[model samples]
Target chain A: MRNILAIIERELRAYFTSPIAYVVLTIFVFLSGLFFRSILAQVLQMGLMSQLQAQQLGPRAMDMPGMITRGFLSTMSVILLFVMPMLTMGLFSEEKKRGTIELLLTAPLTDLQVVLGKFFAGVTFFIILLLTTWIPTGMLYLYSTPASGPILTAYLGLLLYGLALTAIGLFISTLTENQIIAAVLSFGTIMVLWLVDVLANNAESSTSKAVLTYLSILSHLDDFMKGVLSTSHIIFYMSLMLVALFLTYRSIDSLRWRG
Target chain B: MITVENLTKRYATKTAIESVSFQVEKGEILGFLGPNGAGKTTTMRIVVGFMPASDGTVRVDGFDVFENPLDVRRRIGYLPENPPLYPEMTVAGYLRFVAKIKGVPKEKIGAEVKRVMERVSITDVQERIIAKLSKGYKQRVGLAQALIGDPPVMILDEPTIGLDPKQIHEVRELIKGLAGNHTVVLSTHILPEVEQTCNRVVIIDRGKIVAIDTPQNLRFQLQGAERVFMEIQGPVPEITSKLKAMPGVIDVHTVGSNDGRHRFQIEGELKKDIRSDLARTVVQSGWGLYELQSASMSLEDIFLKLTTAEERE
Candidate 1:
């Protein structure tokens, strides 16, 4: 546990010492603000004020849960797609390139400790970036009657999305010593998952479409956006994270033999 | 203590090291002298548990390397050919991180880092970023990292490869000072570095152990035939005949002529001292004995002979 914490601290230091963390945070904030403004404009244009009055409630009494959920979920997912690669691209790639992997490999820490430590560090940084967007998210509570259920679900969904992407990014990082290659590969892989829903809609067979939909991260995230946390969706995201981490462990293990 | 038996590492069709075996007792500084591509780095990597051997067993402090790597790693410190350093980190940060990963107690980490920094004389630059430091200072930081935790065994690969002359001397002194307390196995292509710093030498060639012995013994063992080099102001044929006729003189050959002075190489039995006899013989024969000295083989020649002889066989 001490070794794991040491690795995590080292990784976090590396992240903040460079421009990566700042760049990721800046982009996340900009996108979140843009999405919040867009959602607010749409709410005003749809005359949610008069609609609530017709429902025998005050102008601010109507629940804007759907708008809040869609706005937060869509913006956070996009932000995560871009920020996660930056967070994880250097995890193992930089170590391999700088030859520090040998130092860590020969150290007293186990393989699990190194992989999990790096994984948790990336997740932690992602969470920090995700939490920063919550300031705008919390402001929605003042203007409209937003259901806390969907708000909580959206945050949970964003966390799962970030977790899954971090794992995949870490796995790709372990595949190469070139950070550019790792980032590009991770981005390309995530893009494919992002387009899985589109591909599924065009499928002729129900079974193939259902399979593709189940595999799509967006499809699972939709469940959380609707204030419903299905066990299957939770299991799906967690399993993907687990598999990516397991592959990362194996990649690090293979380095000792082939490096 | 470390013992490697029948160690072999083959990568697909290429063999890095094969059936190479050597033992290092406690507190012994074993110098691994080999040319580039001689598998010194590969063998060290295996011993450090960074890589697995294709076939063989390595025991460190009574623990098998493959089976109990953490146990062995806990007792060993390794510095590869390249110092594994994060350029963005300061020396103090880097060493502190190393101490943590190396399993130094949380409370003692600060003191351990300071102690190693002082030992390597890099305390002045403890706060300087590693990428901005000089190569010598970087190498010193690398050495300092290896000394963290005061592991009983240290495996240094080409530790002095890129250092300046002064830095090399300083590091050599540091390594020598480590003798009698840490079992150090350092690899280098520089022969004299080994002669100066190591108590014993293991010379490897083409992924094989060619010779293992003390520096003096290796020089002595490879000095097969006793020979004396002489420069005389006399006729070449006359001096050669006189020297060849001396007691215990096996053969004589005129090496070369310099400024009208003839030089002859006289070979004789190993146990004989032919210097005085050749001087007397040349002087009594009406020849001027300008210079007479015993011909000695250098470490380079011994290394070449051993490695090349193995190739021939």
Candidate 2:
């Protein structure tokens, strides 16, 4: 456990000492603020039209807070898919490039410790990125009353989604010594996971469509965005995270063999 | 102590090191001597548990490398050929990280890092980023990391390969200082480095152990003919024929002449000192003996003879 923490500490320092962390953080925050304002504006415009319609006819219920929060978070998730590759590209690739993986492999720590330590380091940075979004959401608390339960559940969903995506990015990072290649490959992978749902919509066969939709990462995230708490979505994200981490462990083991 | 038995490392299509076997007793400094592409790095990597050998076994501190790698790794400190440094990290930070992962006590890490930095004389650059340091300092930092946790065994591959003369001297002295307390296996192609620092030398060529013994022992074993350089004021033909016909003389050649004196190098059988007999012959023939000196074979000649001579056959 101490070995894991040492690795985590080293990895975290690696992220912060370099320019990559600051670059990713700045871009993520700026994009989130832009998305939040636009989603808020669209929600407000719809609310105004609805109110005007209610004044003309009878009153109709529309959960404005639900629509705004869901829209903002879904857009945020898509943005994470793009930026997460930057955060995880150097996790293992840099070590391999610099030949520092030899140190870790020769140390007393097991491959699992190194893998989990790096995985947690990426997750920790992802959490820091996720926290920045809270600055925009905190503004919601200042002006109007949003449903606390949906906000909580939505944050959980984003957390799980980010965890799963970060795991995928981490796995991809182990495949190459070039950070750019890792980043591009991770982006391609996450893009496929995100676009699978679009493919599902155009499929002619019901069975193929069902399989594609189920495999689509966003399909599992939809219920969480709608403020519905379900065990299946949680299981899906957790399982994906585990599979990615397992592959990372196996990949590092192979590196030891081939070195 | 480390024992590597019949170790062979085979890649997909070729062998990196084959049938390499040697032992480093407790507190012995074994120099792994080899030319480039001779598998020194591969053998060190396997011994330190960085990679597994394709066949045979390695036991470090009595723990089998393949079966009990963690136990073996815990007791060994390794400085790879490339130094294994993270360029972005400060030297102090890197060493601290190494100390921690090497399982030093939390409270002792600070002192341990400080001690190693002081030992390698890298204390001044402890706060500098590793990437920004000079190559010599970077190499010292690599050595310092290996000294962390004070492991009983150290495997250093080409530790002084890139250093300047002064730095190489300092590193050799430092490695010499490490003897009697830490068993060290250091690799180098420099012949004098082995003679000056190592208790025993293991000369490897083409992934095989060509010779393994003390520097003196290897010289004695391969010293087939003793050479002597003599300058005499005598006719070239008479001197050459007389020296060639002398007892214990294997071959004789006239090297050059200075004024009226002729220089010749004579080869005699091992353990034979023919200087007295040659001098008496020259004196009895009425010639002045200007110079007579015996030249012992250096480790360089021995290494070349062992490595290349095998290839020639």
Candidate 3:
């Protein structure tokens, strides 16, 4: 337990000591802020159009807070997809590149401690990233009364979704010593899983479509965004996270043998 | 104490170390001497639990490295050829982290880091970032990292490679000082380092140990005959012939000449002391005896001889 925290502390310092965390944070905040303003403007436009239509037709009610919550949740999910690789790309790759992996491997700490330490470090950074979004979401909560249930459920789903992606990035980082290669490979991999939904729609065979749709990384996310918390969707992301973490553990084991 | 038996590491392309076997006694400084690419690093890696041997058993402090790795690792400290350091961390910070991971208690981490830093004489630069430090300082920090937790055994690979001469001298002294309390296995291509620091030397060549012996014994065993170098200011052929006539002297030849003084290399029978006889013969013959000194085989020659002897076969 102490060894794991030691690793976690080292990793966190590594993240903040370098410009990686700041640059990723700034870009994420900037992009998310831009999307927030645009979504707010669209919501205002929709409210205006409905108000104008209500004077001519019968009275129609518009859920402004709900619209804002759903819009912000969906946009935040895509923004997270783009930024997660930056958070995890250097986890094992930098250690391998600088030859520090030997220190960890030769230390008294078990491989599981090291792996979980890194995974938790990445998760903690992802949580920090999630908290940054609260600035914009907090503005929504202050200006209007949005139902807290869907927003919290959506965030819970997004955290699971992010963990699975982080596991992918962490596993890929273990495969190579080059951070750029790790980043590009992880981005390409996550992109495929994200776009599987499109492939599912275009499939000619019903069974093939069903399998592809089930494999799509975003379809499960869509249910969470809609506030429909199904056990199967949660299970899918959990299983993916578990499998990726297991592969990362095995990769580290093989690295020791191959060394 | 560590024992390695039939250790071999075979990659897909070639074997790194082939059936290498050696043991390090408690409180012994074992110098692993080898040329570059001679599997010195590979053997140390396997011993330190940095990697696994293809077919072998490494028992460290009564625990097998492959089976009870944590037990073995707890007792050993390793410094690789390249210092395994996080460049962004401070020297003190890095040491503390290492101490923590090595299982030092939280209360003692402060003192452990300080102890290692003072041991390596890096306490002044403890606050400085590792990457900004010079190569010599970085090497010292790596040395300090290994000293943390005060493990029973230390494996240092080319510990003085990047340091300046003064730093190299200090590190050698430090390793020498670590003998009784901490068993050390240091690898190097520098022969003089092995001579000055190690109690026993393992000379590895081409992924195998060619020779393992005390420095003095290796020199004695490899030296076929006792040799004496002399500078005589007299007739070169006369001095050579006169020295060759001595009973214990096996052969004599003129080596070089300058300032009217000729250098003669006299080879005597094994374990014979012919320096006095050679000196007397030159002095009595009215030949000026400028210089006389015995020249034993240096470790460089033994290293070359052993490494190249395999090529001849």
Candidate 4:
């Protein structure tokens, strides 16, 4: 456990010492705040129009805070795909490029400790970036009553989503020594998974659509955004994270033999 | 103590190191002497658990590397050729991280880092970023890294490379000082380095060990044909012919003539020292023997003979 923490601490320091962390954080914050403001404007305008229609008709109902929260969070999830790769591309690739893998491998620590340390470090950074969205979300609670329970579940879902993305990036990072290649490969891989969701919507065959949608990471997030937390969606993200981490463990072991 | 038996590592296209085996006794420094691409790094990596040998077993401190790697790793400190440093990190931070992972007790980690930094004489630059340090300082930082946790065994791959001459001397002294407490295995293509620092030398060539013994013994053993150099104040042809006539003399070649003094290098048969015989013959022949001395084979010649002589066959 101490070994794991040591790696985690070093990894965090590496992030903060370099410019990648600050650049990714700045871009993420700017984009998420922009999305949140636009979504809040759209919701408020729709709310105003609904109130006008309620006077003309009998009455109608709309959960403006839920709409705004769900819209803002769903947009933030797509933004995560763009930035999570930057967080994880250097996790192992930088080690290999600089030949620091020798230190980690020859140290008394196990391969799992190294992988777990990197994994949690990436997840921790993702959480830090993900938590920034709460600033915009906090406005809702201060001005009006927003359902806290669904917002908590939404954040949990996004955390798991980030974990799954981080796992994908972590495993890919181990396969290459070039950080740029690792980043591009991870981006390409996650984008493929993202596009699978769009393809599922256009599928002619019901069977093919079900399979693609089931495999889509974005499909699983829709339920969490809707405040409908299902066991299957949680299981999907958890299992993806687990399988990718298992691959990372195996890749690290294979690297020693290859060398 | 470390025992490596028939360690072999084969890459996809080539065999890196083949059937290489050596042992390091407690408190002994073994020099892995080899030229470039000679697999010295490959073997040291295996010894430190950095990589697996395709075909052999290595037992470190009685723990089989395959069966109990962590047990062996915790007892071994490794300094790879590249130093394995994070360039952005401070020297102190890097060592502290290494100490933590090497399983130093939490309470003693701070002290251990300080001790190792001081041991390698990098205490003054502990707070400096590694990438900004000089090459000599970087090499010392690498040494300081391997000294972390005070592991009983140390495997250093070309520890002194890229350092200035003075830094090389300092590192050699540091490594020599490490002997008798830490069993050290250092690889180098530098011959005098082995002579100066190591207790035993394993001369590897082309991924195979050509010789293994103490420095003096290797010199004596490979010096089978004794060579004697003499500068005789006489006719060059006469001195060469007269030296060739001596019994047990294998070969005679006159180096040069300066001021009517002839310089001759005479090769004698195995286990024969014809310096006395050649000197007596010169004195009796009414010629002045200005200088006469035996030239022991240098490690450089032995290395060249062992590494390159095989291809001639």
Best by TM-score: 4
The per-model lDDT (C-alpha) reads 0.89, 0.92, 0.91, 0.92
Tens digits of per-residue lDDT, candidate 4, B278-303, equal 88899999999899988889988888
Candidates 1 and 4, the one with greater DockQ: 4
Candidate 4 lDDT over residue span A143-211, tens digit each: 999888778889989999999999999999999999999999999999998899899999999999999
Instruction: Give per-residue lDDT, candidate 2, residue B270.
Output: 92
Could you arrange the candidates by TM-score from highest to lowest?
Answer: 4, 2, 1, 3
lDDT of 1 by residue, B166-196 (tens): 9999999999999899999999999999889
Model 2 over residues B239-262: C-alpha lDDT tens digits?
788878889999999888899998
Q: In each prediction, how many residue pairs overlap at the backbone (N, C-alpha, C within less than 3 A)?
A: 0, 0, 0, 0
| Candidate 3 to truth, TM | 0.92
Q: Distance (Å) between predicted and true CA of A173, model 3?
A: 1.2
- CAPRI tier for the interface of model 1: medium
DockQ of each: 0.77, 0.81, 0.82, 0.84
Pairs that collide in candidate 1 are none
TM-score between model 1 and native: 0.93
Residue A115, model 4: lDDT of 97
Per-residue lDDT for B300 in model 3?
95
**Distance from true location, Cα of B233 in model 2, Å:** 6.5
Residue B104 displacement in candidate 4 (angstroms): 1.6
